[model samples]
Target: MIKHRLFWPTASLLALLLGNFIANPGFFAIELRDGHLYGSLIDILRNGAPLILIALGMTLVIATGGIDLSVGSVAAISAAIACLQISKLGDQNSISGMLGAMGIALALSLVLGAWNGLLVAVFGIQPIVATLILMVSGRGLAQLITEGQIITINSDPYKAIGAGFVVALPLAILIALTVFVLISLVVRKSALGLLLESVGGNPEASRLAGVQSRRLIWLTYLLCGLFAGLAGLMLSSNVSSADGNALGLWMELDAILAVVIGGTMLTGGRFSFGGTLIGALLIQTLTTTVYRLGIPPETTLLFKAVVVMAVCLAQSPAFRRKVLGRRKPKPPAQASQTQTKVEIPA
Candidate 1:
C-alpha cells in the first residue's frame, strides 16, 4: 500500500536531492546564525512555498475532477490589490495596514472563487472553458488595478510576512505549512476526503449517495482561490512590489504539474499531500540546479522539458511495461508433458 501510494514520487525527490548534494556538498549543509537557520534546503522550502500553496489547492480542485486555469491570474490580482492597498495607506509600513490589505485581498479572492464556482456549478459550463474565460481576462483586470504599472513599497511589516524568519524557519514556509496542516486535518480527519473522492470518482453516483457535489465542487475552487491569494501576497511581499504583468506567470501550469507528479490523477479522485510536497520540492530543486549549473537561457527550457518528460514517463504504467518488459507466460501443461515423455524415450 505504501509503495502503491507514493513510491515513484518520493524516490524521484530523494534522487534529485541526492544529485544536488553530489553537485554541491553544501546543498544539504545547514548553519545557525542569530537564531535563524540558513542553507540551500531552507532556501528551496522558502522559494517554493508559493508553489506549494498553489499546488495544495490544486490537489483539491483536481480531486473533484476540475481545473483552475485562472489561479495564476487570481494570484496576480491578489498581489495587485494588496500592494495598492498598502501603498495607499497613511502608514504604509504599519502592521495594521498590512493586515487590512491582506484581509481585502483574501476577500477579493473569495469573490473571484465564487464567480468561478457560479460559472461551473450553476451555469453548468465545462470547468476548463469556464476557468479559461477568467484566465484570459484576469491579467487585464490586474493591469487595471495596478494602472498598467508596477506598485512598489518599502514596508518592513509586510516584508516580514514573506521574508522574515520565525524560530529559524522562513515565515512563508511556516504559513504554507500551517495551511497544509489545516487542510490535511479537515480533509483527512473528517469525512470530507471520502466525499471529495466520491465526487471525483463519479459525480452522479456521489449525488445519489447524498454528497452535495455542487457545493463541494464550488467550495474547492473557492479554497483554491484563497490559497492563490495568500501565495500572491507572499510573492509580492518578498519583492516588495506588485508587477501584475509578470507576477504569477505560468504558475498554474507548474501547480498542475506538481499535482500530477505528486500522484494525483488528472482524471481526478484520490490525492496525496505528501506526494504534492515532494513534487514541489523536486521542481524547485531542478530549477535551482539549472541556475547553479549556469545553463544558458535558450537551452534551460529544453533541459527542464526533457526532465519533466522523464518524470511523467516514469509515472506511466504503460511506459514502464514497455521499458522493463512484461513477465513471460508459463508453458502449457500439454507442452510440458510432451517434452518430458520425449526426453524419457530419448
Candidate 2:
C-alpha cells in the first residue's frame, strides 16, 4: 500500500481529515438535512467539485507533455457565456434554456481548446506559450461576453447543477465523480491512455513508432477545454452568478498543484487518476480545516503551502530515504578482516 501511486495522496487526505477531526470534534459529524447529506466532509466534496473536474482535465493535458494555462480563462469564459445567455432568457428557470446555455458554453470552450491545439500541434509552438496566449486573451473575451460585469441569475435548474442533491449526495460531488469515472474508463479501457504516455514519454519516438502525436495532443487539449468548461458551469451555478474577473482566477494554478500533489510528474509521462482524486480532496480538506480551525483568511495560502510542502516531502522517495537513512554496510576490507579464515578450504 505504501508503494501504491495513490498511497501518499490518500494518506495525506486521511491525515488532513484527522487533523480537522482533532481540531473540531464535530468535523466528522454528518446529518441528513432536507433529503441531502450535510457535513464538513460533504461540503468539501461539493466545493471541491470544480477543482476535481479541472484537475482531471489538467491530468490529460499534462500527460501529453502540455500545460493549459488557459483553463482558468476557459472556465471564466464558459461561466460568462452561460450566464450571459441565461440572463437573456425569457424565463431564467427554464431547464431547457439552462441546458442550451450550458451547451453553448461547452462548445465555445472546446473551440478555445482547439485554438490552443492549433498553435501547438499544428503551428509547432510551445505548449506553455500557446496556452498562455489564450490565458489573457480568453479572460478579456469573457469580460467582453459579460460586458465587464457580473451576470447574476435565479435559475433553479441551473443552480441545482452546482448545489442540488441526489440520493443523499451533493449533485456537484456526484458530477465530479461521475466525470472522473467516465474519463478513467474512456482513457484506460481504450488505447488512448497508453498512447498518451508514449507520446508524453517521447514524442519523437512515439511519432517514429507510427503514433499520431499531433492529433493526440490536439485531442487532449480539446478534452481539457471541455472539462474546464464543465467546471466553470459548476462554479458559476454554485454562486448563481458569473464574475468574469473572478470566476476562475488562478484556478489553473490550483489544478496544477493538485495534479502535482497527486504524484503526476510535471514533466509528463505516466499519470495517476486515483492520486489526482485524493489530492483534490486533500486540498479541499485542508482549506476546510483552515476555516474550521479559525485560521485567518489572509494566511490561507501560507498555511496551505506549509501543509502541501510537508505532504510532498513525505511522499518524495528521496526525501523519505534521506530522513530515514539506511544502515551503512562495512567496507569490503573491513568485512574481509572481520571474517575468520577458512584454512580447510585450501
Candidate 3:
C-alpha cells in the first residue's frame, strides 16, 4: 500500500524531469559560488521550500477532512508584522533589533494560531466558513499593519533568513527540513496521527471512540496558521518588502495542490507529509521547466490545472474500477459435445 501510494507522484516527477532534460540539458547542473549554491534546481528547491512547509501543516489539516484557506493571508500578515517591526529598527540598527523583530513575529503567529483554534474548537463553526473570515480579513489586517504602505528594510540579518545559505544549502530548505521533522515526530511518535486519520475517515465514529475530533481539527488549523506565518516571514525576507497584496498571493491554491498531489484525499482521512514534500518539489520543477523552455508564464496555471485534474481522476475509485474492471477474466463455457462423446466410448 505504501509503495502504491508513492508511485504516481514519483512517476510524475520522473517524467517531468525527463521532459525538462530533453528540452534543456542544463537543467540538472548544481554550482556553488561564494559558499552559496546556485542553480536552476537550487532555485526551484529554495522557492518551493516555503510551500513545502505550508503543505506539511496542510497535510495534517486535510487528514482531518478540513481545509485552511486562510493560510495565505496568515502568511501575509506574518510578513507584514515582521517587516513592520524590523522597519522600526533603522537600516543601521544592530542585529539584535532584527532578532527582536523575528521574535515578535513568531509570537504574533502563535497568537493568531490560537485564535483560529478557539473559533473552530470552541465556537463549532465550519472550518471553511471559519477560515474564510480570516482569509479575507487577514490581508486587510496585514495592510493595516503597514498602513497600506510597503515597508522595505535593508537589513542583512533579515535578508539572510530568506536568501542566505547554510553550508551551501538554502536556509529555506533547512527551515523546511526542520519543520518536516518536527511535525513528523509529533504525528508518528504520538497518538495524533491515528486520531487525525480516524476523525477524517469518520467523524461520528471518532467521536463515539472518544476522540476529541473538534479539538483535533482546531489544532490542525492552528498549526496551519503557524506555518503560514513562517512562510510569510521567509517570503518577505526574500524580497525585503511587506507588500501585503503580493506577499502570499494565491499560495493557498498551491498548498492545496501540493496536499492533494501528495495523495491526500480532499475528503481527508490518510495523509502523507513526505508525499507533500515531493508534490511541492514537483510543482516547483514544473514551473521552472516551463520558464526554462521559454513558455509563457501564464501557461503554467493551465498546466497545473491539467495535472490536478489528472491526479483527482486517478484517485477516484469509480474511475479506477471502471478502467480496471474491463480486464477481469470471464468464466469458461461448457462443451456441448462432451456427453455424446462419453456415451459413444461407453
Candidate 4:
C-alpha cells in the first residue's frame, strides 16, 4: 500500500508526530482536565482547526480543477463583518447578537462565493485571475468594514466557538470534524465524487456526458467560501478581536499547500479527505516542532521550507526515480532444453 495516495501523507504525519515526541516527550501525552482532554496533540487539533476547515474547502475546489486564492481574504471579510456587527450591537455579549453577527458574516460569505462563481463559471474567467480579483480587493473590503481598525468583542458564548469544549474535545475540532463527515458523506456516498473527478479530469468530456459543469464548479467555490467564513469565525472567536490587515494573511497559500501535500494533484482529478486531514495535522505538528525545538523565530520559515520541499520531492514519482534510481527489468528466461546456448545472428 506504499503506492496508495494516503500512505505517504499518513507516514509523514506519523513521522512528524514521532519527531515531536523526541523533542518533547509530553507531545504525545494527553491528560484529563475539567472533563476534557488536554495535551499538545489536542492543542494541534485546536489550533489547526481553522486550517483544517479551509483545507477541506480547498480540497473540493481543487477537485474541480479550480483554486480559490481568495479564501484568505474571504476569511478576513467574514471576521470583519461578524466583528463589526457585534461592535455596533447594544449587547455584544448577548447570544442573540452573536448569532445575528454570525448570520451576517455567513450571508456575506455566500455573496462573495457567488461573486467568484460568477466570474469563473459564468463569465468564463480563469479561476486564478478571477479569484485574484477578490484576493486583492477583499482585504480592502474588510478594512472598510472595520474602518481601518481592529474590532474587538467580549462575549463568552462567542469565545466558546473557538475555545469551548464538547465531549472532552475542543469545540473547534468538533465543528471541523462534523463538517468533514458531512462533506465526506455527501461526496463519497453517492456518484458526486465520480462526477467531480470526471469534470476535473476532462471538463469537455463531462459536459458532453450531460454533467452540469458550471453548476458543479460554482457550487465548489460557494462551499469554499462557506468554510473560509467558518474558519474566520473560529479565528476571531479565539482572539476576540479581528485585525483586518493581519487576519488570515497568506492562509490561502497554506490551504493550497495542505491540499497538495494531501496527495490532491494540482491539476485536479482525484482527492482524499483523509489525506487532507493528515496533511493539516502534519503542518501544525511542524509548527509546534519548530517552537519545541527552540529554533530561531527568523529561521522558522526556512526550516519549514526545507521540510515542505522534502515532502514534495518524496511524493513526486519522477523525483523518486531520479534520486533513488529506477530498477532494471529482468531478462527473459532461457529454455531448460539443449537449445539454451543458441544465439541470435548479428
Candidate 5:
C-alpha cells in the first residue's frame, strides 16, 4: 500500500527532471566556488527549504484531520518580532546582542503557538475557524510590531541564517533537514505518530482508547506554529528586512500544497514526512524549470494548480481503481466454451 501511494509522485518527479535535463543540459551542473554551492539545483534546494519546514509541521497537523490556515501569518508575525528586536539593537549593537534577540524571538513564537493551541483544544473551537482568527489578525499584529514600516537591518549573523551556506550547501536546507529528522523521530519512533493517526482516523475511538485527543491537537498546532516561526526567521534573514505585509503572503497555500502533493490527505489521517520533503523539492524544481524556460511568472501559479490537481486525482482511490480495473483479465473463448459444454453435460 505504501509503495502504491508513493509511485505516482516519484514517477512524476523523475520525469520532470528528465525532461528538464533534456531541455537544458546545464540544469544539473553543480559548481562549488569560494566554498558555496552555486547551481540551478542548489538554488531550488535553498528556496524550497522554508516551504519544506512549514510542510513538516503541516503534515503533523493534517495527520490529525486538521488544517492550519494561519501559518503564513504566523511566519509574518515571527519575522516582524525577530526583525523588530534586531532593529532595536540598531546597526552598531546588532552583533553584540544576537543571543538576546534570538532568545526573545523564539519565546514570542512559542507563545503564539500556545495561543493557537488553546483556542483549538481547550476552547473546543474548530481548527479552521480558530486558526482563521489568527490568519486575519496575526498580520495586523505583525504590522503593529513594525508600526506598519519595513525594518531593514545589516546584521551579519542574521544573514548567515538564511543566505549563508555550510560546505557548499544552503543553511536553510540544513535547518529543514534537522527539523525533519527531529519530528520524524518524535512521530515515527515515539507513540505520537500512532496517536495522531488514531485521532485522525477515528477521534471517538482514540478518545475511548485513552488517547488525549485534545492535547494532541493542541500540541500539533503548537509545533506547526514553531516551525512557521523558524521559517519566518529564515526568510527575513535572507532579505535582512521584515515586511510583514509581504513576508509570508500566500505561503499557507504553498505549505498545504506541499503536504497534499506529498501524499498526505487534506481530509487528514495518514501522513508522510519524507514524502512532504519530496513534494517541496518537486514544487521548487517545477518553479525553477518554469523560469528556466522563460515562461511568465504569473503562469507558474496556474501550473502549480494543474500539478496539484493531477496529484490529487492520481492519489484518489476511485481514480486508481478505475485505471487498474481496465487491466483486469477477461476469460478466454476456449475456457467459456469448455464451461458451457460441462454445464450441458451435467
Candidate 6:
C-alpha cells in the first residue's frame, strides 16, 4: 500500500473528507426527501461530474503522449451550439428537440476533435501547439454560434441531464459513472490500454512493432473532444443557459490537474481511471470546504494550490524519503570478527 500509486491520492481524499466531517458533523449526512437524496457528498459528486468526465478524457489523451488544451474552449463551443439550437425551437419543452440540439452539439465536438487529431497525428505538429490553435479560435467560434449572446431555454429534459435524479442519485453522476465504466471496460478488456501505453511510452518503438501510432493518437484526441462536449452540455444545462464566454472557462486547468493528481504522468504512458475519479472528488470537496469554512473567496485559488502541492508532495518518493529520513545500514555490523575457519582457508 505504501508504494502503490493510488495510495497517496486515495489517502489525501479520505483525509480531506475526514477533516470536513470533523469540522462539520453533518458533512457526510445524506437525507432522503422528495424522492431525492441530498447531502454534501451528493453535491460534490453532482458538481464534479463534468470534471470527472473531462479528466477521464484527458487521461486518455495524456496516455497517448498528447494533451488537449482546447477542452474548455471546445466545451464552450459545444454548449453554445446546443443552447442555440434549443433556443430556436418552437417547443423548447420537447424532448426530441433537446435530443436533436444535443446531437448537433456533440457532432460539432467530434469534428473539432478530429481537426485537432489531424493537426497532431497527420501533420506531425506538437500536441500542445496543435491544440493551442483551436484553443485560441474556439472561443471566437462559440461566440459566433451564440451571436455574442447567452442562449437560454426551458427544456426540462435538457435540464434533467444535469440536475435530475435517477434512483435517488444525481443523473449527472450516473452519466459520468456510466461513461467511466464503459470506457474502462472497452480499454481494459481489449489490447487498447496496453497499446496506448506502448505508444505513449515509446512511439517509435510502437510504430516499429506495427502499432498504428498516429491512428491511436488521433482517436484519443477525438475522445477528449467528445467528453469536453458532454461536460459543456451538463454545465450549460445546470443553469438552463449557455454563455459562450463563461460556459467552460478555465475548466481545462481543473481537468488537467485532476488527471495529474490521479498519478497520470504528463509525459504519458500508464494511467489510472480510479485515481482520476478520486482526484475529481477531492477537488470538488476542497472547493466546498473552502466556502463551508468561510475562507475568503479571493484566496480560494491559493488554498487549492496548497492542498494540491501537499498531496503531490506526499506522493513523491523523494519527499517521503526526506521526511522519513532513511537510516543507513550499520555496514552489516561487519560480523565483528571473522570465524577462525576463515584464517584456516587463507
Cα lDDT tens digits, model 4, 4-68, are: 87788888888988888876787789999889999998999999999999999999989989999
Q: Tens digits of per-residue lDDT for model 6 on 1-346? A: 8889989989999999999999999999999999999999999999999999999999999999899999999999999989998988999999898999999999999999999999999999999999999988998899888889888889899999999999999999999999999999999999999999999999889999999999999999999999999999999999999988888888888888888889999999999999899888888889889989999989999999999999999988889878999754465545566566545555
TM-score of predicted structure 1:
0.93
lDDT of 1: 0.90
For lDDT, the strongest prediction is: 6
The alpha-carbon lDDT assigned to residue 94 of candidate 2 equals 91
Q: How far is candidate 3 from the true structure (C-alpha RMSD, Å)?
A: 5.2
Model 6, 274: alpha-carbon shift in Å? 0.9
Ranked candidates, highest TM-score first? 6, 4, 2, 1, 5, 3
Q: Judging by lDDT, tell me the better candidate of 3 and 6.
A: 6
* Clashes by residue pair, model 3: none
Q: The CA-based lDDT of model 5 is what?
A: 0.85
Give the higher-lDDT candidate: 1 or 2.
2
The reply for model 6, stretches above 4 Å from the true place, is: 327-346
Q: Is candidate 3 or candidate 5 better by lDDT?
A: 5
How does model 2 score by TM-score? 0.93
Candidate 5's TM-score: 0.90
Candidate 3, residues 267-300, lDDT tens digits: the string is 9898899889988898788777767777677887
lDDT of 2 at 237: 93
Model 4 worst lDDT window (10 residues): 335-344
Estimate the TM-score of every prediction: 0.93, 0.93, 0.89, 0.93, 0.90, 0.94
lDDT of every predicted structure (CA atoms) = 0.90, 0.91, 0.84, 0.90, 0.85, 0.92
Number of clashes in every candidate structure?
A: 0, 0, 0, 0, 0, 0
RMSD of each: 5.4, 4.2, 5.2, 4.5, 5.0, 3.6
Clashes of 4: 0
Tens-digit lDDT track for model 1 on 59-109?
Answer: 999999999999999999999999999999988888888899999999998
